[model samples]
Every structure is written in C-alpha cells, then in structure tokens.
Target: MIGHVGFTVVVIILKKEDTMRITGISSKPPLLFTPLFPTYFFPTHSDRKDENTWINIHYVEQIKPLKDKKCKVIFVDDQTITVNISAHSMHHQYLNGIYYYYMMDRAARVATFDPDSPIDYTKPQLNIYEALAKYSLFEHK
Candidate 1:
C-alpha cells in the first residue's frame, strides 16, 4: 500500500508540469520576433557584445562611394578614422545624419539612425557637442 501511495504522488508531481506550458494567448506572434538579441528564449549576458556602436555625424568629412556597394567613410576628430561600410547599412542609409555610438557600455535601445534632415558637412555652424548630447544612446537614459 505504501509503494502504491508513492507512485500516486509521483504522478501528481508530473501533472504539475502542464502549468508551466504556454497557452494560446501568451505566446508572441511569429512576425514580432527578430534575431536582434543573441538569445531570445534564454537571455544570458556572459558575452559582452557591442550592441550599438555609433559615429558622430559632424565628424563625417567625406563619403566616397566604392564598388560592390561599399563606401569609404572619412570621419575626423583630432585625426581621421576611415571605415569601409556597406552602402545598404543603416549607417550608410543615414549618412551625414546626427548619430552616436556606444563609447563604454552597450546601449539599452536601438540607435536612431534615421533623422529628419540630412547632415550637411559644409555647414560649419553644426554643433558636434550638441548633436552628441541630443542623439547619443547614453543620453536617452
């Protein structure tokens, strides 16, 4: 009789597993899920990934178009930093626009590359510091 009671208790414990399963209402839609984060089902931050690396718009001096849908970006601070990027890249799509990247830590939100107005490097009046202050992902917090 004691062995039969232990077997019944095991069956009761196994039935509790159904409570953890998701019903029809709570599951996320297929279209809404993107592979932006490395792990969607299980989030682990053991690997420190560069989430949102940004560039200052005012520093963009020249954008030389290259073959194979690439462009050579000329950004200047004390010196020039040249980066070859894809033309279809979010950065390339919003060229000369006010955008900043993460300096120290990963950004919490997606960096807004799309701006209202196109960036004009010829305009000396454009304030680099102000743009950084306004659009930097860190500033949003």
Candidate 2:
C-alpha cells in the first residue's frame, strides 16, 4: 500500500505474516495520549493542556491499515519518553515499526498487555468499526 502523508508517499509492502495476529503489550504507559481518543494518540484534541509534546510529530501524522498487528498501547498520563522517532517519511517500515514498539514500551510505566485477547477497538460492543478504522498506518490496498 502507498501511504500518503502530507507531500510524502510511503510504499509499504507487508507479507501476510507481517499482517498476521502478532500481539505485543505495552511495557508501560505511553508517554503521550490523545485527550479526545483516550485509547490512542491520534486525532488528539490540541486544546487539551495535559498532552505531552511527542518527541517527533511524524509517528502519527498518517493513518493506515496494518491488518492484525494491533498492539496494546498503554497510556499513563504522567510521563514522557526518552528516545524519539524521525520526522522523515523515507525511513524503512521494519525499522520504523521496531522503533515504534520500542518507544511505546520504553515510555509505558502502567501495565503490560493481556495476551489472551484481541484488542477490541470498538467501544463497549458499540461495533463502531468505522470509527476505529481511522487509527491505521495505511489505507487498505
């Protein structure tokens, strides 16, 4: 899939394995969390004064479908991260994904992910797939 973010286009080719049910727990709470969408750091309301200034703004500038590789992203609401991802879009996806996991894990200080269940993005059985669909890394190809 070709991920278009601003003036950049990121071509991501994911094997079926890459898109499989690979799960990971956040070692600690995320350094940043969106005030609006409390489950994720996207679509964050900028007016919220408590949001952390994420190390680099590029980690979530674009939303794309990453299949079933969804992970448990923890949010502690009290701390920030040490390392940051690059702002450039030309970076490789494998490296970027690794860094993404690392940053989230390192920043978290609240809880570990539960491996027994798939993360249900829909709110309380609301089944709002459309609403939760906006949090991807690429659009479905």
Candidate 3:
C-alpha cells in the first residue's frame, strides 16, 4: 500500500515497478492512473508511505503561505485545505507533477511511434529523436 490519509487509501498491486525508469521521477513521484488523460496526484508530505494528503495537481488554483511553515491550498472548485508544508515546497511538488506528466506523455509517444508508419512531415519529430538520443533513453537497446 502506498499509504492512507483520512478516508483515502492508495494501494499499488504492481510488483517491483520501475516508476523512476518509466517516469523519470526519483522521489515522491506523482501517481498517474491513465495515460489517455494524464492527471497527476502528488503527496503533500515527503514520504509516500506515511499518512499524508494527496492533492490533484491540476485542481490546485492557488497556494497561500501561512505561519509555522504551513500553507493553505485552494482548489479550482473553491475548496481549500491547510497542509503542514511550506508554500514553496508545495509549489515545487506541483511543478514536479507537471514534469512527471510531460515525461510520461513523451514516453508514450516514443513507445507508440512506428518506424513503418508514414511520418507526418508537417509536424517535425526530429527534435524528439535527438533529445532521446542525448538523454540515452534508447541506450538499453
């Protein structure tokens, strides 16, 4: 189990999944349920195995810093919650979630790319190939 906070429980049944290899996130990685619509949920605390709140990165509207290194997070639906973490840290986590989503989406695209399929010259894909090579993403092959 990932953890349980309040009434919410997160459990991953997959065994020895390489989340870092697939998502490029080393710590406190956001959870992505579906690749069709990539929405990431990030933990409020550092440890994922601890009792911490998980917030959807897409729904966060604003983060207000409070005293004692805590912050209040406001959602797009006007719901708010006070978390025991600094606003800076919360914002950094939010950015990390976005980065994780981008990497996942890119990986999906790369995996689905067919060498035999006709390329769309109108939309150039050379840069993506170059970036993958530079990062050694295809080195294992």
Candidate 4:
C-alpha cells in the first residue's frame, strides 16, 4: 500500500501470518523420528550375551535441533547410553543427514539401530517419559 503525506511518499508491505511454526520454518511435515537418549536394559525372556552392541533405537527423550533449523529428534532417555546424530534441518528425506555414536544409560521407547547387524522389528519400543510425563526426569526441565 502507498499513501501520500504532504510532499512525502509512504509505502507499506504486508506479509502472511501463520503461528504454527518452529522458528521461521513452518512445521508442515517431515519431522524425522530419531532417538535422543539411549539406555540399556535387559530384554525380557532373553539371555545376556556378547558385548557387541546394535544401533537401532526406539524413542526420543530430548529433541534438540539446530537453533534455526526445523529438524526434530526422537530419542529415548537412558542413564548412560546416548546417540549423537548431526543434521542440517529438522526436516529432510532421510540419509541426507549425518550421525555419530555416543554412550547412554536408560532405555526409552525405541526399537534399536543396527548399522551392521539385523534387527527384529516385531518387538515394541518402550518410552516411559512420554508415557509418564509427571514421573519423567525431565518434567520441568
């Protein structure tokens, strides 16, 4: 819009307004589900075996993306087990991201990640924080 004030000219530009957004990027879709906390608990009806570990995880305890990026993290909360994944945005088509390894202690809702080993998808992941927010260690934090 443009208006005239005496001999001066004034212009106004307008932009659309949307509130359901994380930072400047709209959360339309494509929120990747990756684990944040990696805790190890003995699987039921299973025996302890090798020290070799698989990588498939099942839940996201804390979600931390780049301050200005839209990427979302899905991880479980463990005592000493943790996974460190590095990515650019909160949204992507998968594989266009980067990830490394970390140690964690608690187990949340996650399947498991095996970069070099086979996994049983028929099993269910368990995320207790999400199930019991009030009881979660991160309740107020």
C-alpha local distance difference test of each model: 0.33, 0.28, 0.64, 0.25
Per-model tally of clashing residue pairs: 1, 9, 0, 40
| lDDT of each residue in 1-141, candidate 3, tens digit only | 334653243333220033455566666766655433434778787554465787888899999999999999999999999998899989988887887766655554565474334323245444455334324442334
What is the Cα-based lDDT of residue 137 in candidate 3?
Answer: 41
What CA RMSD would candidate 3 show? 8.3
- Where model 1 places Cα greater than 4 Å from the true spot, the runs are 1-53, 77-84, 88-141
TM-score of 1: 0.26
Pairs with steric clashes in candidate 3: none
Position 126, candidate 2: lDDT: 32
What would the per-residue lDDT of candidate 1 be over residues 26-107, giving only the tens digit for each residue?
Answer: 1110110111211112101111233322344445566666677555656564454333455445343333122112221122
* Residues 54-105 of candidate 2: C-alpha lDDT, one tens digit per residue: 2223343332233243222223443333212232221233233445443333
Query: Where does candidate 2 stray beyond 4 Å?
Result: 1-89, 97-113, 125-141
TM-score-based ranking: 3, 1, 2, 4
Off by over 4 Å in 3: 1-18, 47-51, 114-141
Prediction 3 global C-alpha lDDT: 0.64
Q: Which regions of candidate 4 are displaced past 4 Å?
A: 1-57, 68-74, 78-90, 93-141
Best by lDDT: 3
**What value does the lDDT take at residue 125 in candidate 1?**
68
